[model samples]
Target: MDDGSAPAAGGYVLGSTDREMARLAALSEVYGPVTAAWLDSAGLRPGATVVDVGCGPGDVSLAAAERVGPTGTVLGLDAAPRPLELARARAAAAGLRNVSFEQADVTRWRPPAPVDAVVGRLILVHLPDPVAQVARLAGTVRPGGVVAFADVALSTRAAQPELPLLTAFNAWLLGTFTRSGRPVDMALRLTGVFRAAGLPDPVLTAAAPLERGGDAVGWSVVAGDVAGLLPVMERTGVATREEIGPETFEQRLRAQAAEHDAVLVNPLVVGAVARTPDGGG
Candidate 1:
């Protein structure tokens, strides 16, 4: 959920285009397992209500709805209306009546009532002040309710054979994000964010997908991200259109993986799960 709602705070660098939405769908596949685990650790159960902040296309929101069962409800919020529209359509397609979507700036939006949990993924990094935002979200949940989030740590990407193209891809991703003024290190800072939010110390877990040989989904995600950020790369001088060669980006990445019999490790996604104070501390 890029903040077209608040451009001065540096709107979501990755624009909410169809291509970016597709990238998010692919990313959901990669992230689904780890996210489910995070929710489990946070004790998100059936009959609980959750709010998915910055829910692009409603992936996480839909997942939470499934976990919370028919009696529970999920509200998916995003600053971009396009994703919210897509999210509604997806919920309908999935026959998930318990989940719904809305468009609003997370920093300013307030829930009508306290929920059982408030969650987000890949959202805090785009915020101007993640700690304050976490505190605000924490406030939206009932005392002892769950507050869980996940973010990428690009620096955790690695390859066993150290493929050059993979290296370049990592550099392009990190450079573009850094230049956009987003926190590239948000994953590592989750603990401090939770502590400062006045929540209990969160249980942190991090995982990276490893792909070896043949055509890999990891490469597709990388290519999709580069494709989505081409304009940003050019604007920020991270890399130029000619240099990236978006047309063959995936092919080049796969070719390198095959040639070196390399094992590619995608970025690490870190999850933090904590509960609001039972005493409302």
Candidate 2:
């Protein structure tokens, strides 16, 4: 196992903080099912081999392992060691022997063998050149193998009954990410990325609207994400602690939701799947 304290290089804006880790864990639980369905659509099979790029905490990797069953192998790769530690621990706790993790930068890491598929979630948007990265990733899989990804288009998010704080907070978040040079709406570009990678145009699917109020999970997910981005928000002058502390923001959001009977529609999460050219060796 790699040391967990080494800092990540490249242009990753979201550093590994406790708050960010919590957000990733919550997000995994919320979006794992959607990722699994996307993998199925990519034709993942019971005995196929898959590589999960930027596999934070290994949630989707574990899901893929379950889908591929005992005979298959799932490799979860990440540049950060902290998340890989968590991922390995989770896989161990789940007694999933078929799944394993490695610490390596996704941009430079090449698989020891060609895999049946390559997949990632919310990873490409952080890259400086996501289409180029996708093309590189496509080389690690066998010809005709699957390459799939999922990302969020934050601009598409909306709140019913129109909560002002929520709206402002979302704007600040988008500005923060945008200023950092990350694409806040990477999902909308998946087809182009695939085509640029020399693969056929990808088939795309969007996750159903996530409704708030049935439980606190949805609210918690949003709160954690916003909380984790507070430092960036502050640095970018997008927001400040005095204006939007995590606790205060959650309280206000919940109060407004209750008062207005509002439901929060999360940003659209889009999944795309494409296959490498069959003749490409």
Using lDDT as the measure, which candidate wins?
A: 1
Candidate 2 local lDDT, 234-259, one digit each (tens): 77778888888776777777777777
Candidate 2: C-alpha RMSD to true structure equals 3.2
Model 1 compared with the native: what TM-score? Answer: 0.94
TM-score of each: 0.94, 0.91
Cα lDDT over the full model 2: 0.81
What range of 10 consecutive residues in model 2 has the weakest lDDT sum? 1-10
Kindly list the per-residue Cα lDDT of model 1 for residues 1-281, writing each as its tens digit: 34333233445877787778778877887777888887777777999999999998998899899999999999999988888999999999999999999899988899889989999999998888989999999999998899999998878887779988878888998887777777777888899999998988899877888778747667777878888778777877889989889998889888888888888787889899998888943
In model 1, the clashing pairs are: none
Lowest lDDT block of 10, candidate 1: 1-10
* Candidate 1: segments with Cα more than 4 A from true spot: 1-10
TM accuracy, model 2: 0.91
